[model samples]
Target: MGADLIVEVALRHDRSEWSRIVPELCGGDAELEALVRALLAHYDRPDSPLPEGPYPVTLGPFTLDRELGAGAHGKVYLARRASLDGFVALKLLRPGPGMSEFVEQVRREAGRARRIPSAHVVPVFDAGRIEGGPFYVEMAVCADPDEESPGSIRIGRSLREAQPGLDPGEAARLVEDLARAVHAAHRTGIVHGDVKPENVLLTPETHRVMLADFGIATSLAVSVAPESAPIGTVAYMAPEQWRDRRAPSPSSDVYTLGGTLYFLLSGVAPHAGREVGADAPPRPLPASVPPRLREIVQRALAPRPEDRPASAAALADELRRFRALEPTWHDRRSVSRRVLLFARRHARELAAVAVVLALLLPLFVAGYRFFAGRVGELAAGEARLHGRIQTLDRSRADLERDVARLEGAAESKQKELARTESRLQQLPRLEQALGAAKEEAARSEAALAQRDAEAREAALRVAALEAQVAAVREALADAQSRERAAREDGATREAVARQDAGRALGERDEARRRLSDAEARLRTLERELRERDAALAVARAAEREALRRAAALAPAPGTK
Candidate 1:
């Protein structure tokens, strides 16, 4: 029998009737009759139980093609609108006793999402009741809905599937974008009561973040009533929010943003409690997060709302500055803190400056002493030259006195000879005596000639002494000029030394910072090692107990 004919006969007859009419339908063909009987028996059996919960074929104007995900109260489905050209994410509220209220909440969420105009906020297209079942809301899909095998695309899922947490810079940029979106909603008198990684979607191509799931968002213009309990994820909820169930505000959203950023940086939540103690320390961020950025996150996650940034926009601005390496509010507030942070960052440079200064100081001292000694030598040479010039002047004066004395003696002798010549004319008989007198006069002329030779020699000596004195004066002037030039050179060298010393001081500071960091790291490692050793001791004790138990339970001797 043909499959179509067998299916038709099985649908038309009951089990007992099919058993009785199979032979007649087959027309005496054994194989055809058996096949028809088997098909009839299979069609008579009851169908398997339907799969769980509101498996709708279509919702409103959209066809539910495949389930993207499901949660406690709702299920998200990949769907296509009847009149629309592209696919959309359709979230359906599960059918229950209080589904009407749930549907209204979803409508309110959609309204809130539609009011905000932000690229980071997911847009709601439409929402309505599904024929006779639960309600559905249509949203813009984050990824290519037509692509095959679209994997987990939410921020939480993506992070779980990756090896390391997101980079600090990238995480800051992403959170900044999200903060702007939250701020936009806040400006319209809306507060997203629940902001977490799971509700944040990511586009595959651009990796841009999109905020979704505003199920509990409240509008400040309408009411400020507190909920019975916290309305957001406990780990991400602000302390005041869960502690008193206070009305949600923009600051509460800022706390959640900080928690999300913490998750992105450390791959773990900052704290476990809904109402963590003020003194309780938060989980340390990874070393990858710079100190400035870490401080920003900590401030945003402050226990009290007043301690956090005033608004999500302000937080975004802080993160933007951090990403761009610009000084943040924390940095600008305290000069000392900024200097410390700078030193920590540039430790190596500061250390190098210190080394240079240490080396330059001694050289500067030695150069000063050397220049001082040269100046003293120049001063001493000037004093010696002055003394020599004074002595030469005294010698010239004494020679002039001796020449005057010699001229006086010669003039007196000439007068005496004139008187003797007049007396000899009166007495011509003593001619012989006149000859003797002439001889005496010739001896005196010889003596005068010798005295003139001595005078000429003394004049030459005085002239030579004057020339030596002049030369000494010129040498003294040159020495003074050289001393001035040396002093200037020393000043220049001192200036250069000071500059080098400054650079060295900077280097030394940098080195000290690096050493401090290294010591801190070593201390941390030691603490971790101690903890590991304690754990190992406990494990060894457990192993010993287990071995003893095993021995006690063993079969006696060789009784196997």
Candidate 2:
């Protein structure tokens, strides 16, 4: 009765252990829904029990104990590093359909994680492939991707949930911080190819942005199949990625940052379900955004890669400049606060310039008025000098009378006659001197004419000589060119008759080479023919001897 009852119960109950799981099944999410659908399809089979083993995997210094959670890529394990005596979250590659290469791949991701150098980037502590099996484990001693990151639980369960409620200023700061974090990764030869709110973690107290998941297809050095579709969250993907699936660059992260900010700044995702067509123009920023800030958001989200900021650093510089003039902009959040602080620091220097202008201008105006009053006092002295000069002019008549009395006492007329006679005697000497000057002038004029004639002749000769030299040089160049042609492929040579009438020779060149080659081939053929003749002569002589032997042996043949 026990055996019959057990068989009856097994047949009557559902095979998926569904009766034991009914409560959990009823609360199904997609992950649970997907899992149950898979199990229900195969539960009734009698031949295949659940496949089981150690399912061997290992992290850096620790071995994976057992499954903690089954995920899309593999199962997560709560692993402990034996060396450190610390627990780490490890993702173990499972062996099944299409999982052979996945183990090495997961280990490669973990290898990349160690290379990233930021406090924000999650550290990959250990990675190893299981011996004799296609499985690898990644040991990361960090927060779970499933749990809520700090400073964001106010929005909901995770950073992804909090993104939508972030105000314009907070959103801008977060986006800028993410840009900086991604740029830092790029500086170290890494690229956060996958950038979304979930990959960003904020510190609980400071709200400082932290970029997470450095090894999950986020490094520029990580190569993947271009046709395999970018292995990142779809909503934040740059439009260029959808068209070609090219490896991400700094600008690709820029586009994702813009997308994230767009969602945070406005409650709508820019193109949530649809990407801008590769040929379409970019969508505008939200109307509520300040014009200057909107321009930055639009430029980053441009559909074409060529249209976006060339680098994250370039975009950050542009944002800082724009934020300076944006009166409505909120500087209360993240990195934006630094820009405000910088302006505040320099404000005192600007205020000092203002205060100096106020004091100096009034003093300058008062000094100019005092100088004008002094110039008016000097005007009276000039009029007094003019009156004194007019009085002195009347005394000149008395001075003339004194001069006349002195001339009378000296007998002025006799003195004048004596002086005239002395001057007349020197006239003859002056005439002779004038005649000598005329002769010297005539000689100089004649010499100048002769020099002009000589100069004209010399100029003409120089011109003629230069023309002759140019012609000679042209001839020499042409002759050298022809000489080179004769040495090369030219068969016929035109002799350059030596202008100096010196040595000349005719050399056989291209034509002679052809003749020499032909004669050599003929000689080879003649030698071959002589060898053939000698062989023929020997064969004929042997034939003759064989005939004589045959004749001699004929009589013996008849006797036999």
Candidate 3:
């Protein structure tokens, strides 16, 4: 039957059978949903396979890697922070090309991104809309990077690929810190929808485990999903999550937490029982697991929800008590760790024979007695190293909390922001002033060009006027001589002709005075232009210096 047929038959059935199949039917597994819907639509028509999912999404500074795994909402990728070398898991929406719902989710995430401050919870770094879907970038974290069946970080290096050697004792501390991190989130009124071993990851150094994949996380106890119930990993699902359906609830997280611990301790999921849907309980790994821890694990894994620990806090607290006990498993892990290191360090001497001898039963006993002092030192070193790892975990947690708070403070820009913004407004105005100064300098240069043209024209006119005055003087001299000659002739003819010559001399004097006045005006105008050019040069130098200062202050955005 088609999935539509299956759903209609299953949901609208006589009430008794409806009760049986409903639990298995409703949940968000986006990848599975996409594939199943693709397959179901084609069962009658075998020409089609489910079309491949949408292409990889690139949102600003992050790149989505392959699908890490999926749940009720859908498949998620272990995203790398391409902007900064960090790790984050990105979850895409299920059942949509319509983006209003994705945008709604972005708004909810934007709010949580502003509010929460816990390291174990993957920090949401930035968000925006992308290609008919909404995507968010997050603070990337470290991972084992190769997970086949999901939720397994390799136990030893060769058994796991490129795994770092971390003291198991320290690894235990990290898990504890992760619990505290979730508890911190709970304090802020948020519930991580998915909490399981796969979601928990250690750093490159293996000092801490960061929580990932909050695709279905909710800030409120209520959210819009099918029937107000069953919106998380089924294997890790708490009974209340399935029964009453109040997820993002503490009880729901408590169920998942128990399931997580069960996977960690046993290396096989108690619910899945070594394979999907097996009835047998998986036995604990022989020497790797501590026994008393197993008893507490059994309590947390009780078939009924009410029978389990009330919250993650209680489960973490019980685990803490087990941690305080002196475990022979951790000691053995320490011994094996040293043997590897020793073999590597003293390769020239302990190359082939001693390594084989060390493995022998007699030398194993003899070597412990022989290198008793060295063993003691190595144990002390491991203890100190564990302390350093804890310190790093605390530091990382504090940094994440600080980042979350800063993102919140940035959104609504309070008093400090207002003051900073007021100062910042001056920057652009100053920049505009600098730009205007540059333009003014250019105008001044053009003005200088005009002034030079005017000066040249004035100088040419002065020269012309001087030439005209000289010509007039020459003509006046000729006229005076002629007048003198005329007077001479008149003396011979009639005696005094002085009035015409005196008038000609006076006109020549007037022309000389006018020429001197024009020269003086030209000198004054040239002097004024030179001063203006000097001032423009000074203004340009100041503007260049101001631009340099703005460049220095560019990257730091708010309150810097």
Task: Please list all clashing residue pairs in model 3, or write none if there are none.
Answer: 28-71, 28-72, 28-73, 29-72, 30-74, 87-140, 87-141, 88-140, 490-494
Per-candidate clash tally: 17, 2, 9
TM-scores for every candidate against the unseen true structure: 0.47, 0.43, 0.39
Q: lDDT values of the candidates?
A: 0.63, 0.52, 0.51
Instruction: Tell me how candidate 3 scores on lDDT.
Output: 0.51
User: Highest lDDT: which candidate?
Assistant: 1
lDDT of 3 by residue, 448-545 (tens): 34444334434454344445444544543454454345334423321111222223233444433533443354344345435534544554554444
Weakest ten-residue segment in model 1 by summed lDDT: 217-226
lDDT of 2 by residue, 1-560 (tens): 12222222333456666455533444545554454444344334443222133654454455655454543445556566667654565655433322323334545666665666555565655444444332445554334332455421221122466666566666677677677667777787666777766556565445666665565543212322334656565667787775677767778888877777676766656666654433333356678776556767887888887888878776665666554543222333446665655656668876897799788989988987997887776666666766776666655565556445434422342343344335435534644543454354345334433443444444344344334434533543443353344233211211121111112112224323433443354354335435433543443344333333333322332231
Give the poorly placed runs of model 1, Cα more than 4 Å off: 1-60, 144-165, 215-227, 273-281, 336-560
Q: Which candidate order results from sorting by TM-score in descending order?
A: 1, 2, 3
| TM-score of decoy 2 | 0.43
Candidates 1 and 3 compared: the better one by TM-score is: 1
Task: Rank candidates by lDDT, best first.
Answer: 1, 2, 3
lDDT of 3 at 374: 89
| Predicted model with the maximum TM-score | 1
lDDT of 1 by residue, 134-203 (tens): 5566787767332454543331223223316467887888889999999998987778887877678766
Count of clashing pairs, candidate 3: 9
